[model samples]
Target: MRKNLAGVRNRLLQVVALYAPGGDSTRVRLHRLRGVEIGEDTWIGFDTLIEPSYPHRVVIGRRVAVGMRVLILAHFAHHGRNRESSEGTMDDRVSVRIEDDAFIGPGVMIMPNVTIGAGAVVAAGSVVTRSVAPLTMVQGNPAKPIARCGIPLGLDTPIKEFYRRLTPIEPPAE
Candidate 1:
């Protein structure tokens, strides 16, 4: 009982944090939600929206960074057999899972039934229609593989270490 209550409280807090006044401009709007998990230390930028039509349709992992103007949709409008009578309704619904440490760039669109693998980087302005491999970089309209992470180029350094090496140069004593 306590766990259930905690879960509800967490969900409510998330909704408030995301949709509250003066909070994030990017908000998650849904018709129905169930078992949707957003991990810790994730940053969702402005103008982003996530709408899940069905229950348990969206799951975002930890340390995931979503850029501005990103859209994550979990339902689509499908037309019936009769084209004339079918006006296309939101019937086909699927789940979308963004794994841990994933970086989704600005203006990116993630469709339903897609899993963004762990540590994957989706470039800015890309439309992702399929699953991305782990630790890979994908770009372009359809989001193709551009590069792989953990490649040996002597440039592999922890983010903290890289930042720690930076030094501010002082002006010459004038």
Candidate 2:
């Protein structure tokens, strides 16, 4: 009875933590408590669902942004014709890793055993069936690369760099 209560308590805490107003740090704290490995400065947005079946199997790297309503699944199961028997269904848990600086857009569905390479960008509503290459941009159903990024700046480019490139810098007064 005590064991069951403890499990319930933990589950409750996870749910509460996900929905709470606190930002990425709060989410990381709760997820770590549930055994998911989320790296430094990563922000998992609201309504994102990490794999419940094998939370510990998911590893999110530093500076990653997982957008709202993203679904990261680590387990898959499908029952065959003989539904009652255990052999009829193939059930497996696979690890998922998102490398540093990747951006997973809203409503993306990342399947089991997938690795999103560093600096990759997954467009909104993409269904990723295969692993993405580093610095690529993928989109659409069973996502295919629509664009490949150029070589990174030989180092990490912070998020602010993107905005800086977009908006023109004012020249100093002559």
Best candidate per lDDT, number?
A: 2
> How big is the positional error of residue 141 in model 2, measured in Å on the Cα after superposition?
1.0
Tell me each candidate's TM-score.
Answer: 0.61, 0.73
Give all candidates' CA lDDT scores: 0.64, 0.74
Residue-by-residue lDDT tens digits, candidate 1, 77-173:
4344224424343332236888888888889999877899887778899999989987777788888887775521111346664334433334346
Q: Per-residue alpha-carbon lDDT of model 2 for 131-153, expressed as tens digits?
A: 99888778899988876655321
Which numbered prediction scores highest in TM-score against the true structure? 2
Misplaced by over 4 Å in model 1 are 1-35, 78-94, 151-174
Error at 99, model 2, angstroms? 0.6
Point out the worst 10-residue segment of candidate 2 by lDDT: 85-94
Give the runs in model 2 whose Cα sits over 4 Å from its true position: 1-10, 78-94, 151-174
TM-score of 1: 0.61
